[model samples]
Every structure is written in C-alpha cells, then in structure tokens.
Target: MSSSRTARWILAAVAAAGAYAPAWAAELPDRTPGLWETRALIDGRYRVVRRCFKQGERSAFIDAVGVGACSASAQKTIFGGWMMQADCRTPKALLSGKLLVSGDFGAELQGRVVTSVTPAAGGPVVKRTAMTFSSRRLGECATTPRG
Candidate 1:
C-alpha cells in the first residue's frame, strides 16, 4: 500500500482503540488539548505526524472512534488499558486488526495495532502489518483551523 494509505489505516486503528475506551471506562481520560505529535512505526519505518486539537475536539475523538465504516467487537479492559478486534472495509480492501492502548491519556498515550489486509481481487494474498505509536502534547496549537 502507499505511504499515505498506510498512515490513514494506522490512524484509524488508533482512533478505534480510543473509541473502545467508552465501553470500558465511564469517563474519557483527560488529555491536553493542543498540538500533539505522534510517531508511528510502520513496517520498520518511522513516520511522525502532528495534529491540532481544538477545544471540545478531544471529546469528539471518543465518539468518532470506530463510528465510521467499520465493525468492532470483542472489547475488553486489560491492565489499565483497552483492547478490541475490528474490521473495516474500503473500496479497495478489507482490513481486520487488533488494537491495544495503554496510558492515562493525560500527557502521554501509547498504542499497538496489527492488521491484515486482503485486496478485493488481484490474488488471494493477504498482507499483514503492525504499527506502534505514541503521542505527546506539544503545548498550544500553532494554527487552529476554522470549523
């Protein structure tokens, strides 16, 4: 898959894991709202991305997780964290994966996800990839986008 597509898949998995939080915890963990930098290890390569979190957007992250064209199940809390299995279908491929996240979500957060993607056609081959990521708050957002 292309680099952009891979990044999106990893982000989606992370978001889904965050979504799994509500099923196990009554309230969402507090996170610093501002510029956050995330570094992900995909296929042995490191990629860093940044996102600006506006006020109230943090809460939306909880509700937005796993709310798209995906189905998630087998959610459980483990060792002060959350885990779940999920499957997502796109026009080009079907992705099934397991997501695990650990942290208080206040200042630091970490997660790991493994997914297998099967193409709609081409061949019967399935590609498997694993991604590990961590995010740290970087003070206030540099530029807040208009909503």
Candidate 2:
C-alpha cells in the first residue's frame, strides 16, 4: 500500500473506534445523599446556594446542563472526571455545550459548563456563556415531617 493509502486506513480505523465508544459512555457517580453547599461563578459574579439530594440522586450541577430540549452528543471519562457534550434547543435559541465534572462525590465536587447559543432567528451571531461551580457536602439535610 502507498503511504497515503496506509495513512487513510489508519484514520478510518480511529474514526470507527470513536463511533462505537459512546456506547459505553462513562457517567459520573451520583452525589451523596445529604445537604450540599454549591458556589457558582458566572461572568465574574458569584452565587452560593444549598440543596439536598436524596439517595441515588443526580448532582445538581449535572441537572443544570440538561435544561431545555437537549440531546447528548457524547460522554466520556477524562482527568478524574466525566465530560458530557450536548446540543439543546430552547424557545429563543439553540445551544451547544460541554460540561466537565470532577471530584469525589462523597465530600466535594467541581464542575464547569460552557455553552454557545445562537438566536433562533439571527444571522451569524453567537453568544457564549460559562459557569464554574464547586460543591461540598454539608452533612445531612433536616427532615420535615408531613402533617
């Protein structure tokens, strides 16, 4: 085989491997059941909030990225974390983004999501938004009895 033919075959094989890899998409472990304090930074502004997760609950950070009509394009494990890519459609815009998450779910977690949005009826303009967040488990949540 000529050098170019051999190179093309190699590239094809790599592409085929990637095509099937998403079938085993790696997932981040669920957050621990308890209260968590989450701090987020967006556009140089900071906000903190607390939330409680029940047993087998997904991380709030993960939920934030899945808002609106989204179809996950890819997921994989990387750098002691999981990375997810998706495209989403909302009433006003179409967005594409990636979320990167890391840290042990038992005690602390860190994540960042960056998305680019295009107006549904716009020309070639795109708006980009990003948020960086970190959460620490803050013991158990207080239980409220239902009357």
Candidate 3:
C-alpha cells in the first residue's frame, strides 16, 4: 500500500482499539490529560502522530473513533490488558479486526491490531499493525483568544 494509505489504516486501527472499550470503563486507567506521542509500525514502516488532550478529553477521543462507522464485539478485559474484535466501514472499504491493548494508560500503552480489508469492489487483504504510545503532562494547553 502507499504510505498515506498505510498511515490511514494504522490510525484507524489505533482509534478502533480505543473505541471498543465498554461504556462502563470509559475512564482509562492511569490516563493523564496532556501531550501524547504515538508510534505505529505497519509492515516494518513506522510513523508517529502527536495529540494534546485537555481535561475529560479521553472520552471524547474514544467517541471520535470511527464514530458511527464502527461496531465492536467480543470485548473482554484480560490480565494487564483488554481485547476486542471490531468492524468498521470507511468510505471506500470495510475493515474488520482483532485488537489487543496493554500497559498503563497513564504513562504508556501498547496495542496490536490485525485487520482484514475488503474494498467496495475487490478481494480482501490483511494487515497487521503494532502501536506503542505514551503521554506526558504538558502542564496545560495554551489558551486561545476568542475571535
């Protein structure tokens, strides 16, 4: 796949991992609001994405994951981690996957997602992605002047 396409898939997988958490467990363990750096590896290529979170943004983050396009099943909490299977429909494709996430939600987190993609008019292709992510308390977000 092209770099941009691959990056999109990686991001979708990451978002889906977070999106599948049960509503009752909406608050992530060890989670802190701040700047986070996430590194994702797909087929040996790596990319990094950064995000800044304000207070109570974690729920928003999870809610933003694929929004109405995705649904999760078979969710379970395991020792030191959580696991789920999800399916999502993108504008051009359908993605289904198994996701596993572990580690402290505060300082660091790691996840593995294995996905199978079916284009609107083609055969299915599978992809595996791994993500390692961490966050640091960046004090506070800079206030924006009201326009």
Candidate 4:
C-alpha cells in the first residue's frame, strides 16, 4: 500500500482504539453498546467510519486493529477524560504514542494520539505522526440472531 494509505489505516486504527470500551485492558470508560460514528483527521484530511458494537463484545475494536499490537503503559484520569501512553511495533517501525481522551463518553468523545515512529532498522531519523479523532453514539446496533 502507499505511504499515505498506510498512514490513513494507522490513524483509523488509532481512532478505533478509542471507540470501544477496553475497560478491562486499559481502564477506559465502558462505552455504551451501540453504533458509533468516528471521524478522524489525518494529514489534514478527514475520514469517517462507523462501527457496530454488540452487547458483549468488549475487545472488538482492538481486535479489528490487530490484537496485541499495541500495549498501554501508563494512564491517569484527566479533567474531562484520560491520558495514556502506548507503544506498538509495526512492520517497519516502532511507535511510541501518548493518547489523550476526553468528553463524557456516553454520547460524545474526542481525543488525540501523537506518535513518534522509529524505523526498526535503527535509523538516525524518526517520523512523528499525530491524529485527532472524535466519536459519537449513533444509535443502537442492529441485532443478529444467535447461532
């Protein structure tokens, strides 16, 4: 994929990371189970995606982005949200990021995740990327029949 495309995907994944309730994994607020609309800004362009969260699916977003790909190290409550530090290893680079999440979370949420990517080959240069995103509850999710 093109570098721009890759950056878009990475931004989407980072945004998805904030959409779901990863309370068990990172102490994030328990997101209401429903359909959510997430809008992200990457490279001065905006992209939107919608996701449906079932009643019992807690880690769906994390899984969609690639399970275990990113790990949170430290997190603390902020005035209207939370701040966290995370690290991940991508195919070509290692990423270290600080994520700031805010808003009530029941209806609307917003945050920023800024990352510095270091080439895995031990390069002398590092690339930094910052993505901002917002998510809102769209409504209840459509139900599916049990197998």
Q: Best by TM-score, which number?
A: 4
Give the per-residue lDDT digits (tens) of candidate 3, residues 1-147: 454664565564463235434442543353566666667776566767666665544434334345677676667788778876767676677667676788766656777766676774667574444444333343445667998
Q: Against the hidden true structure, what lDDT does model 1 obtain?
A: 0.65
Write one digit per residue (lDDT tens) for candidate 4, span 1-147: 244744654555544454232433456766677888888886577778788756555444355446666676777788867887866666776667677888865678888877677776767536676778888889998877999
lDDT of each: 0.65, 0.57, 0.59, 0.66
For residue 47, what is the lDDT in candidate 3? 69
Task: Rank the models by lDDT, top first.
Answer: 4, 1, 3, 2
By TM-score, is 2 or 4 better?
Answer: 4
Please, what is the TM-score per model?
A: 0.73, 0.69, 0.70, 0.75
| 49-113 per-residue lDDT for model 1 (tens digits) | 77766654543333433446466566767888777776666667766778787885656789888
By lDDT, the better pick of 2 and 3 is 3
> What global local distance difference test value does model 3 have?
0.59
Strongest candidate by lDDT: 4
Stretch of 10 with least lDDT, candidate 3:
129-138
Which residue pairs collide, candidate 4?
none
